[model samples]
Target: MLSCVVLWSGRRGSRELPRLRPRVAPTSLTRVDFTELVPEPIAFLGQAAYIQLEAFENLARAVATAPSLGAKEGLSAAAGVALRKHHDLIAELRRSGVEPVEVMAPFAPATDRFREASVGADWYELLLGIYVTTGMLDGFFARLSEGLPNELADRVRRILAEEGASQVLRHELERAIAEQPGLADRLALWGRSLVGDTLLVARSALRAAEPSGRIDEDVEPVFTELIADHTRRMDALGLTA
Candidate 1:
């Protein structure tokens, strides 16, 4: 969904940097200046990430239903990429400012849950939600894509129609859930972790920044309600424990 990469060099003195990239930050952290419009660069970049979630959730259903062993494993890998992309973006934002990442840390996924194999079900469920959230927000991209060369818009639309990434996530979810009976519990816990950590980091960002903290609509109540629904569904599925 991201059309191009903009690499940002962290803030220097009182001067703010500019948005430069769609990224995967280094495994070993790096620091840079804060760009003035770091989070909302090319409108679609932010928008696409938001709406990709719709496709993700739908695909998760496919994962739950897939019949092949190969197909199930595939969903896991695809979901992992989607999750990482999200992590990298937020990580990039935090790392760019003069502040240390630890001070404004993003999601810190539970090490233990990921370490155990039992968490596969939870992983698919959460992956689905993340996809749904991202996809729901993607609707705005049409406006963002407007005025671009016709070729780009056409290409993006084609990719969307195919639901490329979400398809991969679904394939894996089906396999994971079918094979990992306890996956539902594990995924529910993971979803809780994603929501909680996101809130913690969000509040921190809101507090640290000025009047209008986050401009993106996808980060607002609509997204929160969806997350709540996801949580409720998990509870209903008897994964509360």
Candidate 2:
């Protein structure tokens, strides 16, 4: 089963972004045997495709609202890359003999909720949100791809490995923070706030045989790596994670 809850919290500059709490109940303190878990092929393809599509859509919107021509161009380029990834995933879905739309439909609501709740209140926040969230999720999906059938896994990894606008987004964020040093603190908090919601989305993508859809304890290390990567991304921007 899936459930979502949003909590509002005040931030620096009085801005607020709603946090999406995880659906799974809290992890038990006791240790348990590890069981490897991987989402089924269709679930993997559908979720991966939808995320790229959402990234493209969000970046396209960012392009429109960007404060300068340079930012607009950079974001437009990033959006194009995301769109291309989406198309590639859709093609893979077709090759597997499933309708793209139907395969992707089941994931739309949860992913959409994630996007909406995590959206930033301004250009800086929005850009940071895009940078932080997408980087984390891409790392996640790429890792999950390993558990897929060999050929499909290779294809998915290659597609995700294609360079996107991480540099552009990073440059833009660093510039913003440098210009207004105060933004570092706020953006750092914003980046920290995003982890729970982002991880929840990642957890939901796992294929669970249990009726409750709880994640296996074995997956904790994967999440640990994802969090570490997220911290590095934040550090690269000179922000605390």
Candidate 3:
């Protein structure tokens, strides 16, 4: 049985952007320079789009491999819901005059590295990754998006609203754990590994996003929130942090 409610209660609240904005060069500035203007938000959106795209594709594969029609249909339905939001995010990027490809370029290494490392993981780990890791990242971006311009933030909220996949994923993992009590130990360890790997990749992406040394002060608070949220998520799934 899941022991924690913090996952539902401790969601990062939406925060509006300050009225006094930083003076940025034009939005039409060069790709390299544009990152300097709004590095984390842009990078966050870009990485979000890339990760969601990959996630839906992976879910589709899982659907295919499912043994029962019931399971396949449930997974498929979740993926279908996710697909619509995925397209919406791409459209929003274009509307914002940002090239999805250009913004996503910098984080390719980290995302790709994560995928490569998980190549041979078992099905439970994959489902748990979707439920825990991806869910947390989605929550993080959704919280940050609240501080963006209204248009961009609305699109991101749409992306974040596609929670069907995570719900289905969480159910599947919980059923597995309930059926096989011993599996919890292994999955708990796997969950920790996933968290560690995710942090490493996130740190690398943060470094790339913030080239200036000034990011030091900003990182600590953001990480404190992330770590706290991560612990909540782990506890919700009956796993130790």
Candidate 4:
């Protein structure tokens, strides 16, 4: 299975955070020939770009109201990363000779609804929400890219790999949990609640790619891996998934 290491600080305690380097299991859908499952190229690019823009917007808002200077700085850096990715994706769209705005417009409503439904009630909840949702979607997009032409696939993979914010968010969440042991139960619940909506966003992307608008049963293993990766992430945080 394809794997990546997630490194975080701190040590294990009874229901407490641990210094972790958990391996994320492969969540790729390429185990079967899935070229036909790839979405229309323009649709894929537009949705990917818009999602990054949304992430940038959310992080920027969090930076504005962050409780501490450290948190503000951390979130601001992550926002910059998201913004740059958005700009890069837009450039890719322009290279394909489409107006970036118009292409992205079609996806706004669905993505917006996903964001609203997953929005957190407070700072900690918001941070975990972003971490979980973005992590899953980024992995999903990377997997989908495998079916794209080689050049586009390479570019998309590179952009997704520049996920510095994931580390920052993980660190922030771990710090919060380490400081407030009582928060583990609540955040654990919040993390679990996010998977259904996040998976819906992912499935919708695949459904849009299919002419019949129905996902294949073969896709089940892909999602199973996604959920496993998600469970590992929550486990790293010493939370029950």
Top of the candidates by lDDT: 2
Estimate TM-scores for all models.
0.34, 0.83, 0.73, 0.83
RMSD of each: 14.9, 7.8, 11.3, 9.5
- Tens-place lDDT per residue, model 3, 1-241, is 1212111111132221211221232232222222132335666667777767666776777788766787788899877876766667777777768998997787677687775554337777777766666665666556656656666767677768766677777777778888987887888877666655555544444453554623343443343455556667767768775
Write one digit per residue (lDDT tens) for candidate 1, span 1-241: 1111222122221212222232332222232212221222223333343323323443455456556666656664555554444443334334445332342223123212222222234445545454333333332233233333455545544444433454554445455666788775565555444443233322223222322543343223322333344344444434441
Q: List the residue pairs that clash in candidate 2.
A: none
Q: Which prediction has the highest TM-score against the true structure?
A: 4
Higher-TM-score candidate among 2 and 3? 2
* Clash counts for all predictions: 33, 0, 0, 0
Give Cα-based local distance difference scores for all models. 0.38, 0.77, 0.61, 0.76
Report the C-alpha lDDT of model 4 over 1-241, residue by residue, as the tens digit: 1132222111221111211333334454345445656677788889989988888877887798788999999899999998998998899999999999999998899899888776689988888888888888888877887777889989988987786578888888889899996898899889877776777677667766655655655565556666677887787778887
Better of 1 and 2 by TM-score: 2
lDDT of 2 by residue, 103-181 (tens): 9998899889888866788989888888988998998888778767888988999999988978889999989999996
As a TM-score, model 3 comes out at 0.73
